[model samples]
Target chain A: MITVSNLKKEYGTVQALKGISFSIAEGEFYGLLGPNGAGKTTTISIMSTILEPTAGEVNIAGYDLRTNPIECKKTIGVVPQEIALYNDMSAQDNLLFWGSLYGVSKGELIKRIDEILHLFGLHERKNDKVKTYSGGMKRRINIASALLHQPKVLFMDEPTVGIDPQSRNLIFEVVEKLHQSGMTIVYTTHYMEEAERFCNRIGVIDSGQIIAQGTLDELRKSSSIKETIAIAFANLTDELFQKISLAWPEVKRFDQTIHFFTSNSKNDLAKIILNSNELGLDIVNIEIMKVNLETIFLSLTGKQLRD
Target chain B: MFQLAFKDLKLFFTDRRAMLLTFLLPVTLITLFAFAFGGIGKAKNEVKEYDLPVCDLDLTEDSKTAIAALDTDKAVHVVMVTLEQAQEDVKKGNKDCVLIFHKGFADSLLYGSPLPVELQYDEAQEIQVSMLQRALFTTLAMVPYSNRNNAQRMLNKQFDKLIGGGNEQLKAQVHAQSDSLFKSVGKGVEANPKTSSSTKIAIGSDIKMTKLVEAKEENSPGLIQAVAGTAIMMLLFSVAAIGAGLLDEKQEGTLKKLLYSPMHPNNILFGKMITANSISILQLTVMFIYATVAFGLDIFSHVPSLVLMIVVTAYACSSFGVLLASFAKTRQQVQGFSTLIVLVMSCIGGSMIPIFIMPEFMQKIAVVSVNYWSIQGFYDIFWRTLPLTDTTFLTRILVLFVIGSSLNLVALRMFKKNILQIA
Candidate 1:
């Protein structure tokens, strides 16, 4: 178990973290959901031992971060938000380099590199430079480097930030597989759906504090809001959107002419239809959706997960 | 950490940028430098072959006088046993120039004018002919102002008017002074009439003069060692800036993976230092072998201690390069800073020029430069041949090692703190 009590960190005038606390257990796929500038990365960096906490008590796998940092670090793996790697070397070489750092012998490093390459379906292009690989291939290699040591806790900061759906699905599958295999994972990201599907528990952080924390279903059961409605409308006009925004004010985000949030779509449907008719707007599609991470984040923070 | 180092070593060779920055570029620069300073250290030691000719036709006093003048110059390299022999040999190209001082050279001088001797030479012997001409002019110019005919008549008139017959003592005294003036001109400037002559000859003085001449020639050979030493010194820095490889690692997230190991940051620093040091030493070793092969320098053979000194110097330079690279954010920045620092150190540290020749303030600055000690150590060992008994060589090596390792320690600490911050 990873336990933290009263974690506080500051960088000169900027108070990045103000007394935050959380915990993670083995086999738990925990997600940190927050908007930009939410201190998620800072927290993850400190937990990974890459950055030190100014004031905190973190016992990672029974090793204190302050006094037993080396031992604590040995139990963890980190996949940075940024692509930190040697671009000049091939994917196979980069993985081997990482494996060696953890004291893996040559034979073992070769074995791990081959296994990870096959597992990620990257064996064919293993010898190509990372810079030449597409965004997703590079991401796979980045995650593989973190997993080479097979640490007790794997901490990833925004693993699926920017990539195609195909690549995103691949990462989600591997992350789920690792969690199912009893590997503890601390995943931080701004994408609500990604977190909703993969995380066993999540913390919705805003402005350096955790506003809400629980399993996806538990957080979705926010006392303040219930249910949600998502609809895809063809040729949704600004006039209709303005009417909806002014009337409901809870349409968190609209993508491809569709708005989703934690608002009640049944009783509010009458008001939405009346406003749309007043504005003479046409509705092409509508659907009532189940409670999800998007609705939970919006209900708890009173703001969108990504502005 | 050792495993990380091995991987780094493997990856260093395969990584195009790292290989280019670390090995290829330094080798290129070393080749360029060797070519640029190509003729250095070579020009001074060349033993020029001078072809010379000598002609002596001396059956009379005047001919003997002229022959003595010709033989006076050490650089003349005279071959004068017979005029016919000189002409025949020079004509056959065995000599560079030949002289025929006319048979009446003494009578012409007595008649108050000198004869112009005939010189024969090839057009290709222009330099040799010119050298002889300069020497001839200098020797002839030292002859005392002569009015042989006028003075003789004046002397006869004096004898006719004053004494009617010669007074033996006065004639003897005049002859003595004239002979003194003659001997002075024939010998050297000491035959000068305007200067009083009181001379004593020290026995075996010419040997001392020969030694002094050799010493003067010794000072002119400084260029060879200076250019070579400085170029070799900067080569380490050019190689060590390969720390830019770290930036590549950081960008690819490989640095993150390396940092996840159970080892402390100090272990990583040691691995890097060893890598950098080994590369620098290898480069210097190759250059040393080249010098030995090309120049017959036997630099290693002459100075048994040079081997150890150069090793320490290379490590120091490369370690300092690591310290400079710790703060740079990118490969380009690391390269730029390394180049600037190496150039400044080489120029100011008496690598380009001798520190003793520079101004006092610059010399003081050189004391702080690692290259200064390195160059000094080399000079003390190689030039002076101080052997193993010299404490200076050992001290310089120790000091350089301490300075290098300390700087590397600081750089490693700085790297731990700031490497993560660069991105």
Candidate 2:
């Protein structure tokens, strides 16, 4: 449903996106997994037609964003990170206004707003102003506003950034249901768990570049390391880290914990203990991690997903 | 405590809107008011000359003497116009008052017969009328004493009439006494210039003061000014706030969401203009209705003109709000800057102080403000009692339309540049 070709964005001297390309099939729940300030929002904004890329050609639902932006906008709904609601107006009023902007009929819009409000479990507080609602409730209404027109694609940028657990779970379920009902969704987030659970395909982006892109199994197969072994040291020093790096060149240090990826966890764990003893370093704890998106991300980018 | 104070100071200075409100607004207002009130320049002691249109029907020497005295007076600038022109000037608010000397004015003044001078004036110009009346009275009082030629001619004519009917001894005695008295008076006036300047000769000539446009109530001028001035000025302020609704949406993120919709971006700005104009018109209507109920304003009689003026005025004011919003980036900036602008416009535009009272330069500058055109339009309707067909009234509407449409065009460009094009 969406295709981006050599999408690059520059803000003055800073390059936000440096010639990245990706595509998402119809009805696919594609997650743009990245840390904050990694150009995730920029990519989503360009695809959603709210922003123009410095050099790019985005086609959404068979319409070029530059030449046919209105048509592109008609096919996609954007749920911005901010609440994006009128505090002085009721949720129903906000929904009605947004729906009318999309040229939705009043009667049909009323029915859609009713169903979406009920689906989000906010039918009871429809009359109250958005300012009176809690953060999670406002977030739900923020997401609900996008569904009024029933666009072919929904662009959700960090929709669950600052919400309660119950609201997050409800949102997750609603998104899963949307995907099942054949709505293509482009979700951007820093949370690996959300991307792991909901996204059929994922793109790991960092520093204005997409480092990796594939299904979960394909990403795991692409990476050279199959597992990760984490070791905590009580008295870790530059000398000890240097000694460990000499033996295992792929060792990554995060504070006192040294994480090294390998295909064999058992032999590496035994060797790490023996090597620590030989180096006269005290081990505090150790953890053997299986192959997962976090490990694959760590293996690919050499940094934590939440960094 | 020192650190906290320093941090707060830094924060306050960093907030551009707060800095503008704290420093720029007061300074700008003070300068505007000072210049307007003639407190900032050498205009403090400068005198204003009132233009008085005079229509002289009588070509007699006595009438000519009176007109020459008024024309030569430093306080009044006399403009010679026909009777029809004088009446039209006063009625159309071009001239505040007209002085007419009827055919028998010279006969009445010389023989002390019924008075034949009329001072037709617009009742709305009460403030200016008083000043004009002072100049007229002072110049007319000294007309006979100050002009020796006319006075000597009048004495000779009367003496000839008496001699033609009576004895020669009485005529000779009257002529000799009048000649000696005039020679002494002219010598005394030549000796002392202050005597001629301060001489007050009270003549019991009944100068008629006629109100050119009859109003429903005697105090309708002040009432109309209060209603119209407050309505237009306050409507500007309200519309400015309402126009800032666009900035509010931007700050709240709803504007970005709206831009994401299928509608054209210009619709957002046009929508704001329509809403603000509608509210302004409603506000003006409410004010007018209230004036009619509480202050006896005859709004029903001039409904058509009043409605047209109100609409144009509202459109102009609403466009002013949109222009302010288009220039400002945030809601705070719009609020602070608009307050300063609207207040200055109101101060100069005859909303707070009447424009006629301001300095000449300031009055010329007042036309640039939306309040001036709007208030003047209201004055034409309620005070001048002009009909919708009047050219002056139609010009006001056209000027307001031009102002509104011009501002709207500029606002659209700015809105697209500063607002819609940004991410």
Candidate 3:
């Protein structure tokens, strides 16, 4: 439902968004994966019509972003990276206030607020000031506010940033449900797992340009490594890790979350996990996670997803 | 639009700080001003009662005339006493000032020339110096003309009947003979002289000082004009001050959320404009009540047109504040700009002082101030006692609306940034 052609934005001396092109079909969940300042937000701004592109064309639900901004804005919703909300106001008040801005009638707006609040598990906290809410509650409300207009297309920029794991998962579930209900989404984040689980197609952008784009499985099959294992634990000493890694030279600690990369996942993975505990290892969780976009992302970019 | 307007007002009114600033601050200050300066306006009319000392050094008929004359000059309440008694009364603080007549003071009056008399007074009363000095000069200027008849009457009398004829020629000769025979006639009688300058009072005349002061303010409406002008001025500024709350909203993330809604930004501005105008109208109403009720002036006789002008000026201030807010990065910045702009307008517009009394250049500066138009509207309403025709009021309303709308348009343009850029 969204098409962006040769989108480019300039800001004086800085080329904020280099020439880039992408599209998301109806009901598709697309990820514009990139680190901070990687042109993800600049691209989304063009698609959302909050900003104008120096040289490009974006059509949202068949309305051009430049020529028909109000019509284009009418078709989609945007949840920015920042928690843009009134802290002094109650959650329901904030929602109703924004709902009115969208020209939503009072009768319809009251009904819509009820459904949306219940959907986000914020029905009980409706009257409480947003300043008193926890980080996760605020993030959920932030995402829910973007969906107030029930736009056909939704643009979410780092929606899960600074949120707790539980709220992050809840938001992930909500977005999954949205996709199933035929709402096209443009999701941008540095979180590789979010991109892997939710996106129908992924675009890995870096330095204002899209470096790679395709399905996770399609890209993973072409990666240099065949399997990628992410091992998470608390207090696994560096000396112990070094000795275990020395026995298996392919094991490299990737800053807190160690990764085991190999072509033979069935045989090499067992010895790796077994020897990991042999030297004072406190293994909280061990899993042979399937290799997808994150692995391909690390392999192609030579950096962690959260760089 | 109504919903937005109501929402903005609801939020602002619920906020105790905003309410206190917009309503409480101005009202408190106005009350304090009344408490402090209320007496200043009517002080001119309050007659200060003071006892004036009259030292009778002469028991002659001339001394009696001077006493009656002192009574006629209403500025002083004459108290007759001997020289020693008057000095004692003045020393006891029972008298404000003292006038002394040396012995043989009537002889100088008979010559139709200057009289030698003395006026002893306190130095603490600076006000008495000017008033008494003017009363002295006025009394002296008429003395020459007054003494001609007295001198004529005295000279027409027999030589033995020296006191019968009130003539300057006979009294001059009798005074010379009395002086020569005083040592020969008696041993107990003594006349000790002091100064030789003339300072005397005679003949009763009326000068209503109380009436003079009442007519001054009645003719010059500076105090009323200043209060009305300042009220109109600060009323507009109170609207602007409340608009600073919108800037607070912008800084605190409320603007972002509000902007993200489907409503146009203009809708939000319109709502704010209404809230501002409504608050100012309420304040103006209260001040007008104080003017008419407390002070007993018909400050609100032309309420309809006054309210119209207030609404227009309120809109203008509100829009101007928003425009300034768009340029400010913080609440402090907004306050700085508001102070600068409001003070200039108040000064030039004759709010702090009366425009009629101000210099011409300042009045010229007032021509450019919205406060000037608002105050002029008030003058037309209260002072001139004009009617409620739409034509008389529309010029001020139109000027404010045009400037205010233009400012609001500029603010709207500033908010028209790319949504994604905010992220």
Kindly indicate the candidate among 2 and 3 with the higher lDDT: 2
Error at B397, model 2, angstroms: 1.4
* Candidate 2, A1-307: lDDT as tens digits: 8999999999899999999999999999998988778889889888877778999789999999999999999899999999998888998998998889888999999999999999999999999998999999999999998988899999999999989999999999899999999999999887888989999999999889998999998999998888888889999999889999999987889899998889988778898899999998899988888788888887777777778
| Model 2 Cα shift for residue B247 (angstroms) | 1.6
Candidate topping TM-score: 2
Indicate the docking level reached by candidate 1.
acceptable
Q: CAPRI band of model 2? A: medium
Better of 1 and 2 by DockQ: 2
After superposing candidate 2, which stretches have Cα over 4 Å from the reference? A237-255, A263-267, A278-280, B1-24, B35-44, B59-69, B104-117, B153-172, B184-207, B420-422
Better of 1 and 3 by DockQ: 1
Alpha-carbon DockQ of candidate 3: 0.24
DockQ of each: 0.37, 0.77, 0.24
**Tens-digit per-residue lDDT, A141-185, candidate 1:** 889988888788999888877887887888888888888889988
Off by over 4 Å in 1: A124-132, A164-166, A230-246, A253-263, A279-285, B1-227, B300-304, B354-364, B419-423
Per-candidate TM equals 0.68, 0.90, 0.63
Candidate order by TM-score, highest to lowest? Answer: 2, 1, 3
Q: Which candidate's lDDT is highest? A: 2
Off by over 4 Å in 3: A229-290, B1-237, B265-271, B290-300, B388-399, B409-423
The digit string of per-residue lDDT tens for model 3 on B1-423 reads 999999998999887556656776576546433433333334566433235666667667876776666566555567777777665443322333566655665775664334545565533233443466567556644443344345443333335464665566767777677555544423332232232123333442222221111112221245456556767667656765777777667665556556545565566667776777678767867776776666666643455777776677667767776676566666666665566567656766767655543433445566777777777666555544446663545665687788778887887776444222343
